[model samples]
Target: MTKQLILCDCLGSQSVDRAALSHATGLPCSRVHTALCTRAIDSAAKAISDGDVVIACAQEAPRFEELAAELERPAPLCVDIRDRAGWSEDGDSTAKMSALIAEARLAPPPVKTIDVTSDGLCLIIGPARVALPAAERLADTLAVTVLLLDGTEDLPLSRRYEVITGDLKRAQGSFGNFTLRLDRLRIVEPGGRGDFSLTAPRDGAETLCDLILDLSGTTPLFPAPHKRDGYLRADPGSATAIAEAVFEIAQMVGTFEKTLFLTLEEHLCAHSRAGQVGCTRCLDICPTGAFSPAGDSVTVDPMICAGCGACSSLCPSGAIKYDAPPVAHLIARIRTLSEAFRAAGGSAPHLLVHDEDHGAEMIALSARFGRGLPADVIPLAVPALAGFGHAEILAALASGFAGVDILPSPRSERDPITYEIALAAAMGAGDRVALLDVDTPDAMSDALYAQTSSAADSATDIAPVLLMGDRRQVARLAARTLMPQQDTPVPLPVGAPYGAVLVDGDKCTLCLSCVSLCPSGALLDNPDLPQLRFQEDACLQCGICATICPESAITLEPRFDPTDAAMSQRVLNEEEPFCCIECGAAFGVKSTVEKIVATLAGKHAMFSGNGTERLIQMCDDCRIKAQYHKDNNPMASRERPRVRTTEDYFGQRRDH
Candidate 1:
């Protein structure tokens, strides 16, 4: 690694942890400066010029960047150790500050962008009397199409836009590619009633429109309609709201950058296995209708995804990864911050996670007005609350954070942050719901200051460890490593990713239905024998196996296994293989085959005869051959009576 200049800021509040910062960042004592903006700017110029700078202050980043550019120096990598670690009244956060800096050194991978080009093909969905005016405003910039839901429509003012009437059945997709399913469509004609005329209604219509200006305020066409891009709906009666919508809708005609938020590993998706539906967590939680069952797998439309990351959080398989930055980068930050704070001898550190918007505002206000955060508190700002899930939460605990607090977006009230906080607590991570859901900065400070006992906050020399592998792997590892230190894993809450599958061997018969349905390969089958295998660590406990098991022999037991056995593969059920009577090849389970024969023999017509009983013991090819031979044997054939009928009839007639 290149030798870098390290600058720590007291952030105009507290004393700097110069020694601890230097020790953690591996920079020499002389090179690391406190209040880098005030003192070290002139001295650090040479290092900045060489592109070897690490600024430990996020608040002054823009100023430093400008200064670096003016000095023809490379832009320095920046991290916030102030609000995150040092802003707290807890004196010198040398260890925590150092960790933040070290974490910042590891660069995040770049994200790919998807471009959505809109040609201004707008659809106005409202009563024509209301929708026509909104369409007129956008007619200049967009190729406007009016879809009237009612029969009475206003006459067109201009010939530029097309007007048609229909009821919108469903509307989906996003900017530059809106798809609408509409029916009961009729066109406007010159001769009918007071308003105008409508052609006879016809059903089943689909149109490809780039934008939708909704005024038919009946029901939204997409989930979380506000989150659906390029589709604007407002109160039909509010003139001001409608005007604002028109302005916003007009600007949506140009090309825009749509974040490729989700990285999909289609194969890892447990949505369906062998054409049987397995996991629908992503589908159930997606605020925007981005995921749809396509064949055996689900397809996610990046264009339609609102980036809530609920899908990623609830995803049993790590098939859906929110890559605003990859999980590794986030985990790296968590590890570094936790380890650094501990290294500097900080005790019972609280990881305060917030986003860049209101959360940031509260931190700033709290610092200036209310009691600044306690020294043990460290702040981490993410793009959104959804970006980090239980994996990151438990990773914080495993890394030795005493507690976790999150400041979520306002819409979080509708359901986002609180739900996530509950999940974290269920996994044995200290619940910071009060701090996260607090209404004011002062209340936030009060909440932080009020904290007393954090069961896992004790300082232990757990070296910073990066979480690896998939979501379940990380979550399992965190629970094993941290929950033991805080508490022990018992029965996790419902929907938890841990637990074992209980199988009744008497009823199982080694059918392997559970094995086939398991998406995580938790339940595996031995090809050479009739056996079902399970790895507790891999079992997401989605109940896919239990749901699909035909014999009703499998049941889910949701419990946390902290021992090595959780990961080791074990036989859930095994039975003797039923060998084919003809080729002697193992095919079915002996018990299952016998059970089937016992149930069917003398009851079903096909299995009644003793000769036919041999068919069950033979392989498919042998059964076909045996049946062919038996039907064609001369001894087995009934004597033919066909040609005697005509001769016998003529002889009988002559005798009479």
Candidate 2:
């Protein structure tokens, strides 16, 4: 029997899932209970044997950091859960608990920052001391005025350092223009407690605003070590609740910047095999390009990375690791379940399910469709189908499951090729199936069985597949399946809408651009088209579609009239495709393209003699030629372009 140790009550949620733990490893409930009541990490660590699963819920009440620090030593399959107590018993708890368990199983921090910066200058003393070079490089690269104050160091020969004297007076103006009162200059070191002033460049405000916008204009940074910006405001409560919110935002932004990165490292080394390398999918999916591999090594640019685990789910080699329990852990549990079934003279097949926001639908579908199967089919909830999906597939194959099935949202089908390969591989392995849960008027169970049969002719017996669906739909589908033909009907909408644009059946090519570009969870392409819904209320009306839509298929109606659904339908349905005169390919819908072209044309007309249409007509090379000729002309003035008071289509510029 597999050994299991669970330490609970320390966390807000389950330290170990008694049912899942028992089902997977064949460990007795008594042993699991014993582990749960244990207080110290050492006792639990001693109790767990080789390849055993040990789960600890490190709640903040008892100082989670101290508990985590105490458990810094190595153990087999030790899962450390963060903020377990406050988590719901079911629903999102699995993913949350699993991730927490994964993180708890890790090591500790080694890196230290000498200083932290605010507005491009060192905001703190310690960070400033060690990060002198980094700050200097940033200043040079950005062409901004950076001041480094030192307490002990002498006036440097280098021009970068401006000596600080106590006699120097302080001069202050608005952002750019300021005259110094400096009669006394004092050289203050970075780590010194002395106060200093940092003046931005003339256009520094513009650059800083642009940078902030480019990074996280909407989302806030969390777990304010020093200070939080954007959305991460600090309120002291239980550490678990605070940590959960911080990590959620961290996962969303992809980085915690300082302490979290150290925690991530400790978590990785702790979980890694003694000789073998653990996964690094977390590093791979980082959108900020913060995490980089350096010759069998990994490095993170904290400045760049937001600590989002987008990379964690996308890493193909499993090189990236999350502080959260990976789907791999759950898959391992499933394998154990398969073994348990065999031990009990059962021949149940396992079905692993993945979804973004919900997993109940898959569970409900299993109860509805998994009738008379050889053994109980399992549904494993996964946050991302990318990294977790692949790991689960491998786990199933190893565990002797008949085949693996992948159920993804309609939006997940954006790249059909990737999904196809994943599904085909699972099918190629044996009894793998791929199904899209399109909320429709048809019975999906029969359709799934038929498709399963056709996909695998060699299989004499075929089990009906499960559907991974939206949160509400999953509930309704579950109710309907459990109580068939009953009048307690959960009225399902034809399609869910995100933001203003409802995916018109005719217009939606299933390209999934809107879902991909949506910064908010306003649009979801889960389960595939027709069934995919959009939440119109969440849309920011940014008109990102007008900017990036390749097909011109998507349009933003600035003024949405809810009274006329038909009018909206007509907008999407009746819109004509516009072909670019330069490249015959359809660029966008005619109206959107015309509007964009007109805006560009007007802007260029003010600066260049050539019209915007002519600029469009000119290729990159031709445009360069025109610019060169314009620049070389004797009449060319060096003066900046004048901003007009008159409002064009958008708005008039305010002259400074």
- What local lDDT does model 2 show for residue 632? 57
Per-residue CA lDDT of model 2 for 1-656, tens digit only, reads: 45454545433323445565444444443333332333454555444422354554322224433444456633344443322212222232333333233333344324343233323221111122322433243333222222333343433333453322332123222111222343333343444344443232232121121011001121232222222222222232234543443333322222222323312343222112222232344443444445555433366654444433344433322334543343334444554544544443434243545564333453344333342111223344454454343334434544545455555554342243243234334222333545445452123334344443454333213232232332122222322232233432121112111125534445555455655655433456543112334554344343444344556556543221222231222223324555545455443455555665667765664444444365454445565555556645555678797765446524534442
Candidate 2 weakest lDDT stretch, 10 residues: 207-216
Candidate 2 global CA lDDT score: 0.37
lDDT of 1 by residue, 195-261 (tens): 5566798888888988888898887877788888888998888889999999998888677888888
lDDT of 1: 0.74
Winning candidate number (lDDT): 1
Which regions of candidate 2 fall more than 4 Å away from where they truly are?
1-202, 206-323, 326-331, 355-357, 360-375, 389-391, 407-427, 435-656
Error of 1 at 311 (Å): 1.2
